[model samples]
Target: MPSLRMFGRDWKVAVDDLAVYAGVAGLWHVVWVIVEIVFLARATAESDQPCIDSEIHLFTWYMSVDIVCFLLYALLLFYTLRGSILDVGARKPAIYILYGISAIYTFLLVINIAASVLKNQFVAPCQDAHRERLALAIFICHWIFWGVWALAALLAFDPFATTSVEQRYAARLWLLKCCSAGASEARPGAAEHIGEICDRAYSTQDEKMESSTPMSQIGALMTLVFTGVDMTTTDYATALILVRNAQRMDREDALAAGVGKPEVAPIPLDMLEDAAHYLPHALSIYGWASNVLNKQDIAAWGCGASCVAPCTGKDVHVGDNMLFSSKNMTIQGVKVMTKSNPETDLLYMSWDNEIQGLLPYYICIDRPRREVIISVRGSLSAADWMTDLLVLPVEVDANFLGCDPSSMVAPEDVKIETTASRRRLISAHKGMLGCAKTIAADLRRHKVLDAVLKSDQHAREALKHDIYKQDCSDHQLVVVGHSLGAGVAALLALHLRSVYPGTRCWAYAPPGGLMSPELSAAMRDYCTSVVCGRDLVPRLSLSNMEILARQMIECSARCKQPKVRVILHPGKKWKRDDLFKPEAEMSADARKTLEAYMRNSGSSHCAGGKVIEARDFLTPGKLLYYEANDSDIADALVFTPQFVDNKEFAKNGMLISTFAVDMHMPWMYQMAVDKALDDAHRGLPSTRVEVAKLEGTCYAPEAAAQTTQQAETDIEAAGGRPS
Candidate 1:
C-alpha cells in the first residue's frame, strides 16, 4: 500500500487516496446511524405517547439510511474506479451531488429535531425527546461526517483543467496576480520570454528549478514591455478626397481669438459610397461602445477589460434607429474565447495593480483576414485618469533617453535600477519633470525607455509571435481609438510608421494640437483622421490651455501660495461640456510641478495626416428653436445654428457650448465620409473635388475617381451614360 504522506516526491494524486478517505468517513456515518436508531426507539418507548408521530419517525429513519447508503456508494466507486483522476469526466458532477445530498440531509435533520420536540409538548417532562441531549449528539456527528465526505471528494478531482475546457483558468489567474505583484523580480530576458513563465505558473506538478519563480513574481514585465501597437487603420485615400482642396487653418492665432470653421471639411463621395451610405450609423460604434466603459473609481486600476463584454446595438440610441451591431461588428467571424477579466471599466483604469498591469488590453485577432486589432480603452467615465494624464507628462523626458549603446546597462542592472533608482530619481526631480522621472523609472525597469519615448514597443514582435503560434500569416496591424485613445493611437503610429510594416492609423475625432509639423508631415502618407464638423475636440488648441495653466501658476505665486494651478479646458470661450471632456482644475504646486512638461509637450493639437471632416452629422435632428418665423417655415433651417465665429457659438444655447459639443459625438464623426461626398455632389459647383498635394510617390484614388466622374459628366451632357 502507498504511504499516506501528503508531500515530498511521493505525493501522487491517486484513486486509492480517495478510497481510503471515503471508506473512513462512510464507516463513521454507519456507526452513528446504528446508534441513532437504538436511541430513537428507546426514547419512543419511554414516552407518554408510546409512538412518536409515524410520519416524523419514518422521515428520520429514511434520512439516516439514505445518508449511510450514499457514503457507502461513494466509497465503493472510489475503490473500484481506475486510471488518472484528471481523465475522469464524472468527478465534478459526482462531487456536486455529494454536496447537495449533505445539504438536504442537514436541513431534514433540523426538522427531525423540531418535530420530536413538538409531539412531546403535550406529554410528561421526564421522558421528553428534547431532553435526550446525548442521543442528539450522535445525529449531529453523522451530519458532520457527510460534510467530511463531500470535502474529500472535492480534492480527489482536478478542477483547473476540465474535460470540456482545457484552459487552466485558476493557473492563469494566479499567474496574472503573481506577475503583477512583483514583475521586476523576474530574471533577465524574461520580458521577451513570457510563455515560459506562464508554463511554470500553470504547472503545480513540475519539479523543475525554472518553475521555481514564485507566483507573485510572474513576468510582470509583460504588462509594460509590449506597451501597445501603432496604427489607427483609417484609409488615407478618403481623407485626401475630403481635405485636398479644402481651406487649411493657416493662422495659428485664429483659435486664440475664438474663431472656428462651422462649415468645416465635409465627408467625400467615395467613402460615403464605400459603406453603402450607412457610414453615420456605423460611426456610432465608437461613441456608443465607449459609453459602455464600466469605470469602478478604483485608483490606478480604475478601468479594466471588463467592458470587453460583447455589445449588441439594442440599447444604444442613434437618430430613432439603432446601430447594426449584429451585422458590422463581427471583427472575428465568430466569438472566440478570450480571457475573462470581469471588472468595472473604472477598476480597469488602475495603474497600480501588479497582478493586472495596465488592464492588460487585448490583441484581438480576426482569424479570416489574419488581422490583429490592438484595442486601447479611452479615458474612464470619471475624470480621475483624465486628471492624471494631465499631471502625468504628455511626452517622455529627454534626459531619460539616449543611453549610450556601448555603455548600456546590463539586463540584470535594469531590474536592479527599476527598484532602486525609481524612488530616488522621482524624489530628486520636482514637478512635472520629476513626475516624468517616475514614468521613466517604470520604463527603465522594462528596459523599454527608448521604445516608450518613441511610442513604439515590442507590440509588433509579440503580435507576430502570436500569429506564428496560431499558424496565421504575418501582416500589418490596425489600431483604432476614440478621444484620448485616438491620441495614443496617433502617437503610436508616428513612431512605428517607418519601423513597422503595414502601419495605418485611423484616428476618429482625435484631439487638436496633438500633431507636430514633423509628425504631421511624416504620417501624412498613411494616417487618416476623421473629425465631425465643428466638433470642438479637434478644434481645441493646446496653446489656449497652456496660457490658462501659466496664468493659474502665477496667480498662486501672487497669493503667497507658491503652489501653481493646473486646469485643462477651453478658457471660458467656446466652452463646451460633455462626457470625456478631459477638463480639470488643480493646485498651483501641482501646476508648477507640471509646468515644464506643459511647455515642452505637444504645443499644438490638430488632426495629423489626411483630415476627413464630417459636416453636421452630430447636429441635432431638427433645431429645438428655429430662426425663421412660421410665415417662411419651408427654409426654417433643417439643423442647429451654424455659428462661424467661436464667440457667436458661445452666445447661443448658453454660449456655443451646444454647437461645440453637438458635432463631437462618435456617431456624428462616423459619417465624415458620407457627408463630404454628399457636399461634393450637392450642386454644380459643389461637384468640384479637392486635389491633394503629394511629397512622395503615393497612389491617389481621388485622382482616378475624379477623371472618371468628369468623363461621365461629359457623356451625360451628350445624352450618353459613361458606364
Candidate 2:
C-alpha cells in the first residue's frame, strides 16, 4: 500500500500502461524492418555479387536493433500482464528500463534518419535511385513515429510532474484493469493494493476541487489544449469531472436536507391539442424564412412573385389559411424578410459577431388568426450552431432582456416564488440569451410592435375586413422557433411578457438546458415546448452529458477486446449492412450501468461550494411530448402527444435511440402534430389507454370535448374570440 514515487513525487503505475508503450514500439519496429529491406535491396542491385561486407554489416546492425527492441517490448508486456513486473519493488525499475529502451531506440533512429538524408542528398547515389528515395521516405516516417512515441511516454508517465483530475481518473481506470488481471492470476493483495491507490487518488482530486477556482481550471484546460491534447476531448473531460463532483456535493446537500423525489402528474389532453394547433405555424415559418418556399408557393398565398428560386420541392405547405410570404414579414422594418436580404441592424450587434452573428428573424401579422408572429429560424449559419454550443449559463441582466431600468425591481421587492427572481439573478443559455436580447432590442428600436398595432387599426378603420376588424389590443403576440431558434424564442417571450402581457412562445425541439427550473416553471402559462419522440436537443444539458460520459466509460470498462480481422483475399467487397448493423445489441453490463446512472441522477439539488450547481436546465414552459407509436402497419400508426408534468420525459439522455436526431427535424414535429389532430377528430384510443384510463382521461369524444372547452377558455382569457 506504500505510495510509489518517481523523482520527487508519487506515481500510480499499472501493468496496463505497458499497452501504450508496446503498441508504439511495435509500430516503430515495423517501420525499421521496411527501411532495412529497402537498404538490402539497394545494396544487392548495385553490386555484381550477392552482397558487400560494409553494406551487409550496416543492414545487419539495423535488423539487430529492430529485433532486439521488438523482443524487449514483447517480454515487458508478457511480464506486466503476468503480474511479475507489477511488484511494488520491481514496478519502478521496470518502468525506468522501458523508458531507457525507448530513449536508446529514439537516439538510434535519429542517427539513421540523419545518415539516410545525407546519403540521399550529398553521398554517391544508387544506380536505381528509387531505392535511395524509398529509404529517405521510410526514415522520415520512422522519425514521425518516434516523435509520437516520445509524446505518448511523456503524457502516460507524467514526466513533467504535473497531473490533473482527469489524468488521475484515467490512471485509476487503468489500474482497475490491471487489478482485474492480477486477480485472475490469483496474485495476493492485488485488490487491496488497487483500492488503496484509488482512495488516495480520489482524496487528492477532492482536495484539488475544493481549493481550485473555475478560472484556474479553465486556464489549465487551455494549457493542455496547447500542449497537444484534443481540445474537444479535454473540454469534455474537464466538464465531466466538474459536473460529477458537483453532483456528489448536491447529493450530500439533499441528504442533509431530507429532500425526496417530487411527484409528477400526467399531462392533459387539452394542452396536447393546444400545442398541436401551433405546430404547423411554428414549422412553416422555417421554410418561408429560409427560402425553401418557392416564388410560386408565395404567389399562391396571394403575395407577389418577389422570390427568385424555382420550386425546390421542399416548400412547406401549411394549408391556404396560413400565410408566410416575404411581403407580409419584415426584419427590423429595414428590409422585407427574404433569404437573399435577411441582414438587419441587429445582425452583427451581439457578442458572437466575430463568428457570423445572430440569425435573422422576421415579424409578420397573421390577419386570419389576429396574431403578430415573430418567427426565428433554427441553426443554419455557423453563428446559429455556435449559439447552440454555448450552453454555459450566464446571469440574465435587465439590459440583456431589453428591460427599462426604471421598471426594474430588487429581488427582495419581487414576490415571485421562483428562486432565480428571489435571488435577484436569472440565468439562461449564454448564446441563446444573447440572441434573445438582440432580437428584443431590435423589435423595440424599430417600434415593430407599435407598427403592428397601427397596421391593425388602419385595417379596421380603412379596409374594414372582418379578420382585420379585431381590436389592436386583442392581437396576441406569439414567438415561434425551432431548434436553436426555439431556445431564443423562449427567452424572448419571457422578456416581452412584462411589456406585452399576452405574449406567448411556441418552442419546438428547444434545448433542454435553456433556463433554470424555476424560471422555466414560471413561463409555463405563456410558453409551450413541443418535443417529438426522443429528440436529443430537448434532453441535452451538462448534467445529462456527464451522465452519458459516465455510462460510456462504464461500458468501455466491460467491453472485451475486439476480435482481430484477418483479410486473406484482395478485392473482396464487404456487404455494407453486414459490416455495420443498425440495431446492435448493447452489452448487459453497459445496459445495467446506463439504467443505474439515469435512476440515480434524475433529481435536482443545490450544489454549494466552488462547484457549479449540478442543477438540471429544464426546457422552458409546459412540455408537450409527442411519443410516436411503433406499428408495422404504416397506415395504422397512431400519434400520442401528451403534456408532461415533469422534465422526466426528456431525462433519459442516452443517444441510443435511432430517431434521436431525426425526431428534432421540424417536419417530424409537424407530422406528429398533424397525426395527433387526426386521431383527436377520429376519437381513436391512445396507445397508453390503460394509463389514460387510470388518470381518469380518455382520448375519445370526451377528450375532444375537453380540448374544445379549454381552447375557448384560453381564447377568452386572451381577450379574443375562438375561431
Q: Which candidate has the top score in lDDT?
A: 2
Tens digit per residue, CA lDDT, model 2, 371-457? 777777677554465467555456677655556432434445344535332232356776788788777776665454653454545
- lDDT of the candidates, in the order given: 0.32, 0.50
Best by TM-score: 2
TM-score of each: 0.30, 0.55
Question: How accurate locally is residue 334 in candidate 2, as Cα lDDT from 0 to 100?
Answer: 16
User: What ranges in model 1 sit over 4 Å off?
Assistant: 1-361, 366-370, 383-468, 471-474, 546-655, 671-723
**Model 2 misplaced regions, further than 4 Å:** 1-51, 68-105, 117-359, 379-431, 454-474, 542-617, 629-639, 650-658, 665-671, 674-723
Candidate 1 has an lDDT of 0.32
